[model samples]
Target chain A: MASVVGEEVSNKQVIFKDYFTGFPKESDMYLTTSTIKLKVPEGSNGVLLKNLYLSCDPVMRILMQRVVPKGFSNYTPGSPINGYGVAKVLDSGHPDFKAGDLVWGSARWEEYSLITATEGLRKITHSDVPLSYYTGLLGMPGMTAYAGFHEVCSPKKGEYVFVSAASGAVGQLVGQFAKLLGCYVVGSAGSKEKVDLLKNKFGFDDAFNYKEEHDLDAALKRYFPEGIDIYFENVGGETLDAVLLNMRDHGRIAVCGMISQYNLDQPEGVKNLMCLIYKRIHMTGFTVRDYYHLYPKFLDTVLPYIKEGKIAYVEDIAEGPESGPAALVGLFSGRNIGKQVVVIARE
Target chain B: MASVVGEEVSNKQVIFKDYFTGFPKESDMYLTTSTIKLKVPEGSNGVLLKNLYLSCDPVMRILMQRVVPKGFSNYTPGSPINGYGVAKVLDSGHPDFKAGDLVWGSARWEEYSLITATEGLRKITHSDVPLSYYTGLLGMPGMTAYAGFHEVCSPKKGEYVFVSAASGAVGQLVGQFAKLLGCYVVGSAGSKEKVDLLKNKFGFDDAFNYKEEHDLDAALKRYFPEGIDIYFENVGGETLDAVLLNMRDHGRIAVCGMISQYNLDQPEGVKNLMCLIYKRIHMTGFTVRDYYHLYPKFLDTVLPYIKEGKIAYVEDIAEGPESGPAALVGLFSGRNIGKQVVVIARE
Candidate 1:
């Protein structure tokens, strides 16, 4: 077997075949090998990176489809699909980076990339934990759960918390964090396995498989008779409307994502927003990147809990880059039990 | 006909007509003229009030419709409508209130009302300002705009502010307050007169009549090519959808009311909520009842501005109780230019 080394070498890259119309299929991406000189070009400020592991997020599904007003740049047809990933430095002309250093941040989904190391990249120093942990529990997903719960929800002790998509990367941490804060947490997942994991592994107060429930409103009422105080919203549409009816006075909703509505031609209408007026609820949507400055503080808070076994994390790692297409597509179908991570190589 | 001086006597009162359907027409209400004795019952702990001024708010329109699962009480048929109003104390058994004292808070729309001197009501000490002002500017509407802008929106100097329903009670004050904070303020109103008031009276940097605009998104883009930093939302539906497209990164929206959707069978679905995820925007809905504790602080902040004529106020006062039905109904149709008040009698 040939290995990639310091030479004028060829790097295999994955590129989007064309703009996806609906749900992204495996055929939409094709891997192509190309050669490039290993030396950094003169007067250029870019870093040559050898990609290790790439994070497959549900949001990437929306980025593949056509959305109006062009929110974030969608994957360009016949070009590299960019996302967050971990990489090793190969060659550097940027002032902040050097060769052989490990870094984890936003990068393109390819075997190798020459990136400008803009505001997105951060050098990974501590390897006490698996580097893959940054892709799931300690990176964007972790910060998302942390900031949405602490900053947006502003939860108090003994509050009743409800999480949707409860077994995913962010929802799992949100449930655990709420439990640590002395809250009574209930979560909803798609499958029985995920529901059991919520109750047994993550130590949620209660959990249910939303697929089995005939009426979501009744399910929510059964779980929260007194009504929910904080709702960590990941799935929008009917679930949001049902939760709106079940929210207690002064309830707060931290909207992290709306996975259910992302791929639809038209999103579902919410009929119960008038509840916000009578109940005086606060519904806020936030992105994890806005809270990056709190990364060190988040590590200080979550790491101790992790070491003491007070916090538990789960991941569904796909073995190789060839399976990346399947792993990313599985997110829309709720196939991954926890965080969906694509493993390129074992270090 | 003679005026009854501070004499203790039984008086006729009006009661709410049943829950309304579709648009609330005048016939939905009934002035029953039932008599309530001007005296607190023996061993009772409530105050008997002479209702002077009644506020007609948009929320009352929602209460008149059918109830949902998270339902609240609607006005019973053959009964009077209820809302926040100003009244004079006729008799009192509650220790916190005294006879002949002035008070302002949530009260029923009637000639006489017996209310418990609970936490919702406040004894009015400063009566030098027009007593009717409590029905609009210095009352629940005032506190709503104050808290929604200062607390929720968190405006900073030089930020661009956009207020919908800008000449209505809350939006008018929000635009002025944003301007006073050194923000560049723009407003959308239904009528040209309101647009003029927004720019001239409220000191808004720019104003537009949304009714005249062919496209709401284009109107927003024309007024704010760089995008709005803060949006004080009153009319929801398309306005909210348009504002979402024109929001700058990290914009804040204070959702005080959604008058446009109150009468609709099903509220319009918002398509651009995903913008919040990408732009890191914050949208929060609040009620004045949650922020009444800031009344004294509000008085401190607003009184000086009012005295110095730095803050301008407009009112649409109806002469008698007969006009109350039309005045309240007019809010939905955008007939009233400013605060809508129904005056039963002048003190």
Candidate 2:
């Protein structure tokens, strides 16, 4: 393709209208075409990039709301929304990055973005595998699962493990990692299709459709008869309470996320927390950002597994930046089967 | 005192009348006098002990209720209630103990008890300090504070620490321990008297009465202007939710007990748990039993501190075995200033 000199290039960007109050709607986001110069600005230590693929995560919805004392920074209205994405460098002024370098980290949801080389951003030198894998299976979600399980859960061989949202991005990797450690892995998903994937595809010991299981306590009892040694908690609420009742002595719960209670006016109460006293369970919550230093170690451990088919990954790609808003919001409704990613521009 | 031959002695026993529904009442525990021969059965390994002192803890209430599937054995109704106490051995068949030997461990709440030589029991050879210290300052609660802070919380010097129920048995030790580690310690109590004791007696950096503070979040903000690094959680519920908002990056919460919610039909919902996702806080629950290996090390570390007057301990001693029921129930009502103990037959 010939470069159009002196011509303003039109880039499609997703912008948040205002802070969200309740469940977000598609109308809350506006996809607008904006003009950007093809070159990096002079004296600016910034990298200009064309986004290839964007990750659609549940946390984006939390960033859209205004919470007291500010739980975290929210996306500014009228500004292009930002999250983790894989991009191709168009132009750069930083010494570490250059034009044509493939980088993956936090970036704006647009065809083009001007981002400073932040501490989190890293150049993707090895793309022997699919580049889109950086958005889910090989990137943030993968690191989340890896760090949460190995570092937080600290699973030993023969431990019984339970995972919630087991077919989703982080949960899928956690289930696989637990199985690799010789653990008896059981997972819960919203639908039978996802449940089947957990068992047949992901190689989990057992899978249950949480929607179909009327009695959560009974379901946990049936699945974890001896009791769960480790629980990778994604969906917290009654499931946590039920898991509490079935935790073995010295059990560990790695709280990655509480997706079920995120959007509720009032999160559900946990009635069996007193069980933590008797069972001496360790229920801990952690995030991927704090464990980013282990990313290199994580890649070294996981990349070989991916290449040799020792580890499997599944992605549900939504084409075009226009579908980004819907793709992100669809997470809450259980619409995405695996790691949800939006393909902005394929290599 | 001369041994009365062929004469049966009257043993005053505190018995559980039935399963308690909610908060236990004195009526629930019936004091009955029964005759015993004051002799150990032949070939039996049980030790017959005259109970000198009994420690009353909040966990006893949970034991009074019918057994739930919490993995541990619950106290049977119409049986003698048992917990940590300092005792004098009246007679013994166990090789490790003999008559007149001082022992501190789990024993029944009666004038006399026939206890088997269990693994948890230990003979108290060092009487350099008061024997009652075995029930509180040097025993289970002390070890709880040590393990929860050092092993679970992993405190660093100059880190900000918050202890709930600061004037109570475990909380006082936690606050003092955090201070001794060069951390800024703040605590919360139920009344003004307890708050004063926390600041004056326990050497806490700052203390507040949770009952007086209408807004717990505001109270936490007032104390922890930056953020809390470690939260020694004794009273959970709203206090936990408040602390969640004020927790710094990588903060740790050691969940010891949730006394505030013990009597509630439903546990309180925690809203700011999502903060864990953003801040990457590690909130973990632990019981001291799992860390018993550290007891000898704990004694080495704490005994010297006590002797040097670096650590101070307070106790509320009730006069007789008949007062044991009221003293145990008083824990729920915040009626005791410090560790509640009943003096049955002090050596």
Candidate 3:
């Protein structure tokens, strides 16, 4: 690879158009080509990255709304969206990185990105596994499942565990982790195929298609006759309310994301919070930012499972920059079967 | 003081009429006269009690409803209601009690009756403190505040603590406990008089009348500019919804009882639960039943505060057994200022 420093290259990018109410649609974003200098500027801790694989996550919709969390910088209307991705460093002024080092963390939805905030970026150490694992099972989502389940949920062996959005990025790993711990794990997902994946591929004790259930409370009761001891919450609103009613005494709910409420003008009211007190349930909300300090420890534990064929990962990849917008939109509609991803470039 | 254990006495009782929806009313229960032998049954673990003071609690309304918890028996339509009371034991079949023992725990809302469940009962140790305090500050409500705040909320020194229904038996004590622990304590009550008590009497840093606030969220923001660190959630529904919006990151909520939701046919949906995730909050629910094991520890801590004139206790006593129904009903409408106690006999 010859030095392409200061060379202007055509950067194909997925651009957020504007924040809109209701469920996100494909037209909310557009793909465009622009020129970018493939070099880090002088006297700056910045890394210029060639974005390889971009992730389509539920949080994308949360950032798309007019109301983002305090101090969180959402996507700028004209600029390319920032998300988790596997990138190859083309040039670097940061002491932590150099040219040809593979990394994963926060990156823009563009062919080439000048990443000023290099704090979130981690250098990819192991390459024996598929590089795409850095986008899902080994990245933010993996850390989320690890921290939320082991730390927040405080799961024990033989305890009954329930997971919502069970076939999605964070949910799949959580169910598997719970099962691997000798817990009786049950998961609820959108479609029949995803439910099948949860039961057959993920080794969950049972899994149900939430979309087909008329009575969520009854559905939960049927799966968890003894009541749920741990709940990994992703889908919120009705599912959360139903889960509350079925939680056993001293249950723990780890709130990762609420995909069901993200698109609504007004999120649904949770009526079953009274259950929190009656059951002495501890409902905790957390993010990967708080737990990333344990990344090294997380890798040490999860890698052996990956090597021994103990941990299974599923990814729904949409090839090319053109498919990015639709891939992101499909999350709200439950169109993606597993961890949704978009490939800007394979290598 | 001669034994009159075998004598039949007229037992004036407050009988629950029937289960009804919406807010409880005085008409829902009626005063009636019945007869009972003033002695424990032969070989049975029963305590014959002369009920002195009956507590008017919000949970009374809960038991009056048809939707009681599993294995929990609700108030029978024609039976004298069971509640917390300070009583003089006339006779005992259990080894824990003897004749002339002053005790507090579960008692029927009647002048003289036989109590079968003695597990919740405790022999009142200090006769110097008002026996009525056992029905309020020294008994269930006092234990409730102690456990919910110190144990459930996990309060740290200098943390911002907010108490809803701040002048009530539990809330007043919680606010005072937080202040005594070097925390910035604020409380919201239903009346201006109650608000005054929270500040001047209970030693809260500040107090507000929640009834006057048109926007509960703005009201909380005005009081807690830094945002609430621990919320003593007594009034649920809208107050809880507003508190959720104003909570600081990593806030803890201790749910003691949701007084606001108990009266409603349908509980208000808490819409701001998304805050639970955004702020990494821990919302926990608890009951006095599970925490009563720490009763001895609680009495040790709270008694010194009472002896030093440090923990101020205020009780609103309704004279005579006839006032029982009205005093209990007053809780829903915020008609009672402090701990509502109905006295059958002062001594």
Candidate 4:
């Protein structure tokens, strides 16, 4: 068979079964092979993407739950589940993208995806870094950590910063960013290995394993004796409640995600919110979509740090889409260390 | 004894007996008549106050709690209960306050009090408003409403604003401010009469009795189909949880007080805090102390409104210091309408 611009090709896709109840499992999604034409649809300004690397994020669980968050669409059943990914444009009807152009944005868990929403998609300009970095450090997660830390939290020098889920995709960079900005940073992770990575590798002032602590408030007091000035909230629920108690006066909490609460049929109740008044805390929730305009500035700041080895990122990469479901489900159980990713095709 | 520089005067006081459990009742405090000097002491920069009007606030319950919030001290036993009040400076050893000065600030619930902490004291300027107004509409609660509505909530024209505990001192002003700024204001009170006061007297576009509604979320949905843009949170716990679900994207919640949770041994779990993330909501807890710098500006904005009949104020005046305990305790039971104030003397 000769290669053609508009020829049919085999597309292996992960299909979401349905909106789930308490916790999601690998069985919630199934893989299937389908045929797709290697071209954009007629009269549509869409781009044909051959997805290379897909990100396994905690937010996908929220989109999969019964009620999808505002500003995000639900993953319809019998359709390919989608998230941020690295891809090559095989064909384009949009002016900004063309054949062979490398890009990263919203992509389906399939071999090929025709993305009609072209605005969210951005062409990958710098090739010196690994293309897979677009799925973690240089893409949505990176932007999330950047905007959440610098813009939302409005951190100042020598502030006491605490990051929950500190060894994961966004938290690791937030700790690093706070440290770079002359802040005293502490992090909490589930495993000892991740804790060690946060303290030694990520330059956190101190790190603790949250799983070992029965009293989160006491653990936080041990780490942040003077109380936390900034909290980069990743895993919510009980952690958030404890963080509220330990927050300093006028503390700022940049809420990026709540992985712990995502799987619950009823999200855990947070009781210490009264501290927000006593401490004058500003707890704000935000998404990367609102901060995409800062991408250029983020790249300028982060690319240098990455090149100079000032920033370190770790990826737990699974080989293929067959491993995607387990890898995604494992996030709830703390199975993946650092940023979780699955490669559909490395190219 | 005849009036002299340091003559002793009989001072009737409301003394807090002890920090007791459950709801604050009249028995938690008792009346005691003690002798006090009518003059400020030598070598001390204290002002001798003749407390005329005392404000009964929900925060007094918090100060009486086992864990007093930071920046606030617990009420020591056998001492007169202190809160924001209107007082006359009978004698002063400080230059800022002189003898016969009319002032309003932190005052003890006694006929005479030597206020050593005189920095918080402010000499009443515009006497055109009722002297009793210093305890409610033009005093600390007024400043609280002003700073909270203008600075914290950051409202805009045509925005949908909701005020909880709407018939109370702070909530009433907040609703009026939102309405005066051309915003659609809805209020939730504990009683039907208070609800009527909010809608008819306070100029709220809509009002609801929170106790009457079985489902607060459904109640809010009925009033605000477009969702709340700003929530002036005076009553917390379940009401806050309900408001979280009914908030629009990027909504702001100015947490003025948590009257509902103050007496609870364990605050109710707010399950919908994740709504903060889903809606990109900004929920901030604040005390009037942080915004005291805006008092002069607030006076400039609000004084004329009070004078011109643009802002309506309602007070549930409980006459005499003997009535203080019941008036203050009645706040928890929602027995008092509007601002609950205790008048010690008219002149």
Candidate 5:
């Protein structure tokens, strides 16, 4: 490929139009095109990235709301929204990154982004796996499952583990990780296909379609007869209330995200929280950003599993930058089967 | 005192008439008498106790309900309800206890109790402090404050600590313990008197009457401008929901008790729990029984403070065995200003 120096290329970007209160729609964000110089600015330690794959995460919904929840920064209206993504370094003024280096971390949902904050950017060393995996299974969601389960839930062999939103990005990996740890893992998804994927593809001991279950408490009782020792909470609300009653003594709940409640104007009230005292349960919330220091150790542990075909990943890819809004909005409606990703440019 | 072995004496007792729902009343229990030989039966390890001071705890109310919560054994109807008390060993078949040894542990709400389950009993080593303190400051509540604060909350020096129900048995001590660790401690109580006790007696940095504060979230923000580093949760419901919003990143909540929700048929829904994830908080529920192994170490630390007047304990004493029902029921209504105790017989 010939270098196109000082040339302006049309950069399509997703922009936040307005803050949302309840469920977000495609109109909440607008797609706009502008031209960008495909080169780093002079004398700046910034990396110019041609965004390849953008991750559509549930936490982005929280950032889109008018009042950003505590400990989170909101996306500015009219500015390009940024999230975890895989990008190729088109130009670099930074010491670590150079041209042609494939990197992933935080990137704008646009064709090109001049990233001044490149401290957290991880340089991709291996391309044996799909590059898109850097946006899901090998990226933030994977680390979330790894850290939330091992560090927060503290699973022991033969312990009963239950995960909500089990077919989603983090839940799928958590169920698999729990199974690998010799735990009895059960997962709950919204659709039958996702449920089947959980039990069949992810090797979960059991899986249920939560949408079909009218009585969540009874469903939990049927699955976790002895009681759940670890609950990887991804979809909070009634599921949490049911799981509370079914938790064993000293049960651990690793609250990764509450996707079910994210878009609701008022999140459902958890009524059985008193069970936390009765059962001596520990409920902790965590983020992958805190566990980034252990990325190498995490890779060492998970990479072998991937190579051995012991670990499986499922991705729901949206074809182009134009599909970004619908793909991101699809998460709140439980429309995505697995990890939702928007592909801007394959290279 | 002479031993009256063969004589049948009237053993006045507070008997649970039936299981209760919602708030328990004094009428739920009735006074009765039964003849006892006042001697330990042959070939039995049961220790006979002359009940001196009975500790009125919120947990007893749970045991009195028809459906008992998990991890706790229910008190039987038509039987003497048992609780923690200071007692004198009248007759003992157990090796550790002898006649006239002052002890504090599980005892029936009666003048005399035949304790078959004496394993949890602790022989009182210090009579220099008030024997009544055994039921509150020196017994279960003291150990609860010690373990829940240091072990569960993991307090750091100069941390901003908030305690709910701060004039109550465990809360009073938790506030003091946080202060001893060089933390700035604020406390909330239901009454102005209790609030005064928290600030004037317990030495809390600040105290508020939660009853007067219509907006709990605003009150918390007023107290914790920067954010709360630790919350010693004794009262749950609205206070918990408010504190969740005021917590700093990685703040811990040691759930020692939820006195506010114990009597409710349906516990209050904590709406702001999503804040747990937003702030990466750790909310853990703990009971003192699990930390009893550290009792001796706890005493070594707390006893000095009590003896030196560094720790002040307030007790609301109900005179005689006849007053047992009212003192026990007073806990639910927040009528008792401090540690509620019924003095059966001082011996």
Candidate 6:
């Protein structure tokens, strides 16, 4: 595989500049040029990948912050940024993958990435669908929604499901999945456009623009008259507090992410947690990494929905590696309405 | 069953004069004498009870306040304050109960209570144990501890357990139960006296006085150097926030009560909840009432421990029904050392 070396070419990469405190800005990361051998080093046990599509997620903000929380690693200042991405294998020293194999997993944000940690990479078996779907609908975010909804929320037919940031990457899929399970799904988003997308396009039973609602509790009560049984929590803070008050007995809250609290120096104080006791609510937080074992099952369940046109996905794609900083930062300000993706190259 | 009858007698009752806010005072309740015929109505099915022991629990404060939370009914004004109590059935029109039967369930804080809702009542089977034990060790609080620690927390042998307000009725039992499962148990109490009782009497592995510790997170870190496997949340607010930070991956938090938040106008906001997402923690809140259906199973498991002196119960007995208000209020101020019980009549 090392024999396919081309002439020395400049490989563009996004570098983490410094540790961030509050909200991360575009300047927090800078572009740099580097040279790659275009091949896996001799006797090296790793895969050489040509990056195609990069995923811009909220967890990136936490990785950019000064002190990373426990069980999570921070991006090094001088190194290239790493995230979930779609890539084509150019060279492979590992037996599982070979050249020309398109895969999705953790990768460095550069034209070419030498992935030493290649165990998480999944080989693309179905090419009939758009390859970029591996970065979202078939990738980390996909598995997240699949596992978070089915295993975490433990949804039952006709149960009331409420999702926050419902038009975002993971939340949108959760709403659709809940609807498919025969749940009465309601979603809350920041804008009318997102809310409309949730109801009209994604098949949510109802949707509301949280920004317009002065009283979140009242808005929730209006949407969920009997109270919510399953809450797919993507945005935390005020939304979480309100949901706590409106959850039904034996309710389940799958805390997938707290996108609202990531940029803040101090996360908002949730005041209605006592409601958890009275309602006998179960709230759990999880990461997609732990659920990758179900990736095969997830694909089997979700692939038919995609091929049959039963599931709809919206991606806000930015072209070229130069657009990486803006594409990532736009997530914090809700500048991107749906799943934020950055395309580096085509096949 | 309504055969017993007696001449009219002046029944001493504690009546709720007004709805309370913030902290309840003795003035919120006043003594009233009412004449009773000491017999059930000829056509109606209700029990006439002579109250023996009343359990003063923290949740009573929430019921006494103006606004009741969902899933919990509030005590009405101009009515006797009701709580879990042990009583002697003077007369019963229900087929399940009869005159001279000993029962414990929802009963009024008065000398004589005409119990219309007797479905929650459990007839005493084990007369060998002290009858007052029904209010603390063998009744609501006992079932609360058993179900909370076993069913909700799912304690495994050699696991690390943390109990907040550990010398109180439910907390004391939780610590002992955790120890019985061969888990390493630590407890936090308000006073050094209670702390000592947790370690020396309740068989806790370690105990700390939360009042003496300025930083709860630091205190928790010192006690749980490795991490907490399960947290029995009897006291919420800051303790909950700290426990969130120190929890191990997949830790369980059984929220039985939030005594610290019951008296506050606005419950304190929990700030470190993001740990839940990072550690993949599970936090659930429940009540003993929901688990009461397992009462026979619980008694079968816990009764032998009591008989063998493996479980110790400490009670702060208020001499008479006149001491009810002070005994109940003392819980918020940390006056009572253990389970607060008001004795009405012995036997």
Q: Supply candidate 3's per-residue lDDT for B184.
A: 99
Q: What residue pairs clash in candidate 6, if any at all?
A: none
What are the per-residue Cα lDDT tens digits for candidate 4 across B1-347? 12344788788999999887679989999999999888887898998888888999888998886568778898998888889898888888898888778899888888788899998789998888888888888998899999999999989999999999989989999999999999999999999899889988888999999999999999999999999999999999999999999999999999999999988888889999888887899999899998888888988988889889999999999999999999999999999999999998776
Ranking by lDDT: 3, 5, 4, 6, 2, 1
Model 2, A194-230: lDDT tens digits are 9989999999999999999899999999999999999
lDDT of each: 0.84, 0.86, 0.91, 0.90, 0.91, 0.90
lDDT of 5 at B80: 92
Candidate 5 backbone collisions, by pair: none
Model 3: how far residue A82 lies from native, Å: 0.6
True contacts preserved, each candidate? Answer: 0.53, 0.60, 0.81, 0.90, 0.73, 0.93
Candidate closer to the true structure by DockQ (higher is better), 4 or 5: 4
Lowest summed lDDT across 10 adjacent residues in model 3 chain A is found at: A1-10
Query: B1-347 in candidate 6: lDDT tens per residue?
Result: 12236656777888888887887888888888888989888876999998889999999998987779776788899999988999998888999899899999888989888888888688999979989999998999999999999999988999999999999999999999999999999999899899989989999999999999999999999999999999999989999999999999999999988988988888899988889999999999898878888999989988999999999999999987678888988999999999999998886
Rank by DockQ, highest first: 6, 4, 3, 5, 2, 1
lDDT of 1 at A141: 93
TM-score against native, each model: 0.91, 0.96, 0.98, 0.97, 0.98, 0.98
Candidate 5 positional error at B99, Å: 1.1
- CAPRI quality band, candidate 3: high
Worst 10 residues of 6 chain B by lDDT: B1-10
Name the better of 3 and 6 by lDDT.
3
* Candidate 4 per-residue C-alpha lDDT over A1-347 given as tens digits, one digit per residue, 9 for 90 to 100: 22256989888899999998778899999999999999998888999988899999988987886667667788999999999899999899999999999999889999888899988688999979988899889999999999999999999999999999999999999999999999999999999999999988999999999999999999999989999999999988999999999999999999998888877788899999899999999999998889998999999999999999999999999988899999999888989998999998877
Candidates 1 onward: DockQ, in order: 0.46, 0.56, 0.80, 0.85, 0.75, 0.87
List where candidate 3 sits over 4 angstroms from the true fold: A1-6, B1-3
TM-score of chain B of each: 0.95, 0.97, 0.97, 0.97, 0.97, 0.97
Which has the higher lDDT value, candidate number 2 or candidate number 6?
Answer: 6
- DockQ winner between candidates 2 and 3: 3
Error of 1 at B59 (Å): 2.1
